[model samples]
Target: MTIDAKRIVVLVPARNEEHSVADVVLEVSAALPGATVVVIDDGSTDRTADEARRAGAVVLSMPFNVGIGGAMQTGFIYARERGFRAAVQVDGDGQHVPSEIPRLIECLEEGADMVIGARFLGRGDYRAPLLRRLGMHLFSAALTVLTRRSFHDTTSGFRATGRRGIEFFARTYPSDYPEPEAILLLCRAGYDVREVPARIRERESGASSITFFRSIYYMIKVLLAIAMGMTRRAPVRRRGEER
Candidate 1:
């Protein structure tokens, strides 16, 4: 079953990415014609919002920097409220290839509640720094054990979700380090989450948000969040199963 492009929304969460946000918006528009491109400007001091608007994207400007997690939740909330059937997350820095969005949507159509665009799935030559690679491997292993399912790129931000995922995340999403935590949340709730190979490019401009010290902090905080999440009861029962 081919989903209509009009029922999909491409969400771009940007912070201080004035130089590349416009181009990213344009690229997404071209890649997925007829889809709504909404840019969640996470309190960027630069002209990120203006650039996105000028590039023909709907802009949601936050009052202040709410981090990636908050920005993404805002997009999901919008998707849920606006009645979009599916939503795709494309980063503002141009790392994610908008052209690959259809692959994710295909997974959603195939009964996946959420689809992650994994970078290290043997499809791309994209390489992370040594420290970041180690973190990814560690998170993948931890999530594999906790969820009883394999995960390769737990830290990947490129993703897409169907209506079920959109509604669930809108209601309850983590505030920090949400990517990995979100996987656990969905699995515990018995949602089908899958990963697909995707090629990623280096950021078009600006430095990465994860600095050396912040990487350490991110790892520690996310692990703690996962541990706490494990003890909490599943927010929703498995799909198509009795309560």
Candidate 2:
């Protein structure tokens, strides 16, 4: 399963990350030479789009700020429309290491529809705040139960998706708190979703959008979203079928 580098697209979804987006683009280009890197500028008032283009990345500037889910779906749609065989997600804030991307791609090559770069897998010394950590644990537990499989890091945004995953996600991606919900969605849809250890660093600039009270709000809202998702039947898909 040796995929051509030209057929792979690295999707970097960013918002107001002008300070670090260029560096991230450069690193992704260097790490995966010949792979197409597209940065989705989520309506940043700053110079995010300009910085990304200057760094040799294809920039997709949104009309306004669509959150992470909308930004990422735009990337997947681009990948699908352009007939990319695989899509890799790297945050624009430079928290995700480009060098570790190969690990996730390897899992995809090994037949995983999607591969998550798990931070708690002992490969990195990354630590989250107390409330955030608890929320992660809750989401992980709920996903494990819902999917009947183990999930170590449900909130990690670092991930890679093969063709099947790209097509599915392009059509049906959650709009809010998508990381954890996406795992359950793919798993329930009968996709091979796996996780691998990867290193994640602190963001180079800007603070997290999830603040103290926001964390609590995020937890409740996401749990409700997950519950609603569980009530619906997963879409039927024929394995290996292309849309």
Candidate 3:
């Protein structure tokens, strides 16, 4: 019997994304065949789970509404339990193009611990709102300072994680505003990262949850969490660790 060393999985953390859930899952399955696609349905009021299951992806439906961070941590735990070597964290929104997923795998195979799809890195006509872009840059600057590394995109949800990254976040991950906080956590954990050019499409349907007021507070709160996480160290004893 032979086993494959290169096991890749795509994780979609979704909530009330019935409009976009099926397409996202089907597209990923089409792009990367022979790999499992798991969609963590985060207590969607709509038909997100049904649509995802119909699209041929395994759906892990949360009993209650957990934020994106919790959904993502669930994916990490599944990956650890399943012994998957590489996993890609993709949003349920249609914004992330499934065609670009392989690039992240290539980044990991090429020896990078983490790869983030940067919209500014030779991208096409990106349509992110002006205010969001401004906040994105500000958070990027703050994260670089906190992690002591150079990173242009902190809030971009398009990213890939290797074995090291999967195990790291499964143990300790942020509760809110995790897309950026994960970057700081990974950097502080001594993981090497690479940013590559990728063309992301605009959201096809469903309104984004980020409002102007929440975006402001999200920026501040995430920045503070990352700063503190960077400075703190894990206790010598983990939950299941034997002393």
lDDT of 3: 0.82
Question: Against the unseen true structure, what C-alpha lDDT does each candidate score?
Answer: 0.92, 0.92, 0.82
RMSD of each: 3.1, 2.3, 3.0
lDDT, candidate 2, 1-243, per-residue tens: 978889999999999999999999999999999999999999999999999999999999999988889989999999999999899999999999999988888889999999999999999899999999999999999999888999999999999999999989888888877999888889989999999999999899999889999999899988988888799888676544332
Error of 2 at 53 (Å): 0.3
Q: Residue-wise lDDT of candidate 1 within 132-238, one digit each (tens)?
A: 88889989999999999999999999999999998888887888778999999999999999999999998999999999998999999988999998999877743
Candidate 3 C-alpha lDDT tens digits along 8-32: 7789999999989899998888888
- Rank candidates, lDDT, best first: 2, 1, 3
- TM-score for each model: 0.96, 0.96, 0.92
Clashes (backbone N, CA, C under 3 Å), per candidate, total: 0, 0, 0
Model 1 lDDT, residue 20, Cα = 99
Residue pairs with colliding backbones in model 2 are: none
